[model samples]
Target: MGSVTTSHELFEVRRIAIIGAGPSGLAAAKYLIAEDSYEQLDVYEQQPEVGGVWFYSPEIVGVTPVPHTTPRGPPELPIWPKGSPAPLFSNPMYQHLNTNIPKPLMQYSDQNFDSQSRLFPSRQDVQTYLIKYSQDVRHLIKFFTQVADVHLVSKDGKDHWELTSRSIITEEQKTVEYDAVIVANGHYSVPFIPAVQGIEAFNAAYPSTIIHSKAYRSPDAFKNNKVIVIGSAASGLDIGTQISKVCRKPLLNSVKTSSELKLEQENKEEVPPIAEYLVDERAVRFEDGRIEKDIDAIVYCTGYLYSYPFLKSMEPPIVTNGRRVRDTYEQLFHINHPTLAFTALPQKSIPFPLSEAQAAAIAKVWANKLALPSKLKMIEFEEKRIEELGDGAGFHVLGFPNDARYINFMYDWVKTANDGFAKEPARWGSELVHLRERYQEVRKKFVEAGGQAKTLEELGFEFSLKY
Candidate 1:
């Protein structure tokens, strides 16, 4: 919030500053470079290399460690400290962790996976792809540089963004001005740990016994230990199952709290929500009045929060709370000053392709080739969205079918804007759209079919039902 302007005319955006060198940042650089209007593009990344959260670092340093807590079972990761400085280290990408989505669905619109790669590639494969993509626009990136602050300055009836960055090694500070800023810093670093009633007592009794999933690196560390995995989401289930192979007895504590909980039912599976912790007996008490003793460790699979400490220093802070951003139109451009800044497309959508579409669309808007909805219309959209989804988590959460709608909007915009009017920014073709639709259709059918069927040989059937 620098100088308030009454005019909504398109401003000439020649120089752009992109924060973070992750997929979104790289995609922004790619599209902006493709457009001839943008002359100078700068990408700032905190890490020594290109991959933002994908690059796995062995050492755990400069991290905002999960604080102590007390709970019935294991403690949740503490709330992200608002207005706090960025940690020195990055989020952990465990060794055996693989992509949850298939390679075909996760690939960028313009890029393809390696021919020899598997369907669900490893984290290393994704990091490699990001690195290769970074190489395509390496000239624009300033490695080992961290963006400290971004301030809005109005000069001669126009808005300009001034970004201050510091080198991680030498600690030298420098400030540069740009016509626009793209917050490409992805939301995987700062963990969102829930609070528990008796977590502090438990942590004091058993030091280093409870940890967040971000601290988990390998199953070897949990071997012969009695582990309790909190949450039943993808990471929680996958990590718990992996540790169960080596651990003495690993219990999966699901907060789903549903009577209709459906699972294959492994040997040591318990489905009660945690009620409280028994510090005296060092046991876990569930809501069902059952007590579990001799529990060794707990792993929290709670996700990360969208924390941008850098934006707090702005004239008027961009992030209102831990929940959502303020005055963002379509979750992309700033409603008041559309030209000043934009938060890259968010939610649980296909990362690379969604980023590609968003980057292209943003480039169009910055180039004055495309127009956004009226300010009143934009505010109405956000209000209606919050009404349907509720506040905070509900607002940002995008499920399967909803993701299709969002991406399709970007695709449609790219197509409509390029209809013989302005030079076309790279278009996300029908191929990607078709892939999402077909993937959703197949997934729906598969989910409805429920658990996997036994092989024909095991069932002793003459013919398969799939045929």
Candidate 2:
């Protein structure tokens, strides 16, 4: 219900509609407001609340907690009130849930959490952090509005967009126009439930036990009961890891969850070639051999698929079969749809603070180009590379081959994006360790067995520093 834009904010913005009030959308609003760039910015988020996907958890069955030994990043900042509405997922998670990312690496370049914090912050703690972020920039957000659809509009010879939205609180539909829109509405809104045979029949025969990991809040859902968790992604691991110590034998249907080939078990070496198909033709079964039919619960750690209903008509959809649209020059902006950008999406990595810095770089260049600034029109290899990449080839966010993941700290990637290349800002600051150390100590270890080395030379990195 808050937006930083006063009645007179000295912005040329017509009217902008942001479709989600989560981190990315809120971040964008902060920039637009603090930078005094937008004339009017209104964010629409369904569910009568903010924190979209992190909104709620509904219990069904088989979802329980086990020992939580998963690696973590930093804690989340809670933005929601302690006494929100229904939706058990809305309740605070157990004390053990932390990010898969480490604290030092995930902190924004401009700020760091208190030094006395844990290595990775808990989900609730991080939510509290986001709440702080929201408070700091509360004037930039509007909650309880869900965007239904948007249509492109052309006036005279110029193009603009008309957005259609419904205020859940007011129960009123409204229309607005904008010069640009940033769809911070992320993927994972809908669960990716697998279409395994007999699933529907199994549900009919034994209703209410099947559910997705998103519904799981705590082990309270599975006390003195056997549980089953599917999917092998981070969430799957987190949930399964938690439920394992509790569930009699939390059966898992290991599949192509991780880009890497390692399957980690507590106190066990990472396993390889994870079983693609469960042996009994059933993802989970019970001991009585009731045709493998009944179970206390079945948690589909089933991964989520990225979707953009707005971009449905964009020819090659932005994502294909759980994979992103092919080819990105700098791996940031969409090749074919230059006006549209997916800032925080990753290929094989989790969310990190680096995304914010990267988003800022893209935004600067984008604003300059839109306003026809000469600084952006200059000649350079970086620009050419970006232009070449705009050809619609290599239009993927996961980088090439879709096998490995990489994050270069050079910041030159964004340089290639806007002016074709330039030195990163010293104000951007440096991490605890140099880029060389990151590569030698971190990057090299993540490569698959037969991967090739991608150094500054190959990456068009002209400068050198310690690793």
For candidate 2, write residues 175-195 as lDDT tens digits: 777756667776554356655
- For candidate 1, give the lDDT: 0.67
Which stretches of candidate 2 lie above 4 Å from their native place? Answer: 1-15, 33-37, 47-96, 250-253, 256-294, 310-337, 369-410, 413-467
Predicted structure 1, TM vs. truth: 0.83
lDDT of 1 by residue, 1-467 (tens): 44443226765789999998888888888877876678889999877678777877655543334442211121112222346333245366888876655566677765666755544567888898888778878887887787877777888777788899887667799999999899988766656666666766777787777788887888898789777887766677567767877888535555654312223335247557667777888878777788877788878777766667666555455655456666677778777777654544467677776777778787877887777777788889888888898767667777566776676677678666643323232333455445554543333333335413222122222321110
Candidate 2 has its poorest 10 consecutive residues by lDDT at: 67-76
In every candidate, how many clashes are there?
A: 12, 41
CA shift of 38, model 1, Å: 1.0
Deviation of model 2 at 289, angstroms: 15
RMSD of each: 7.1, 10.8
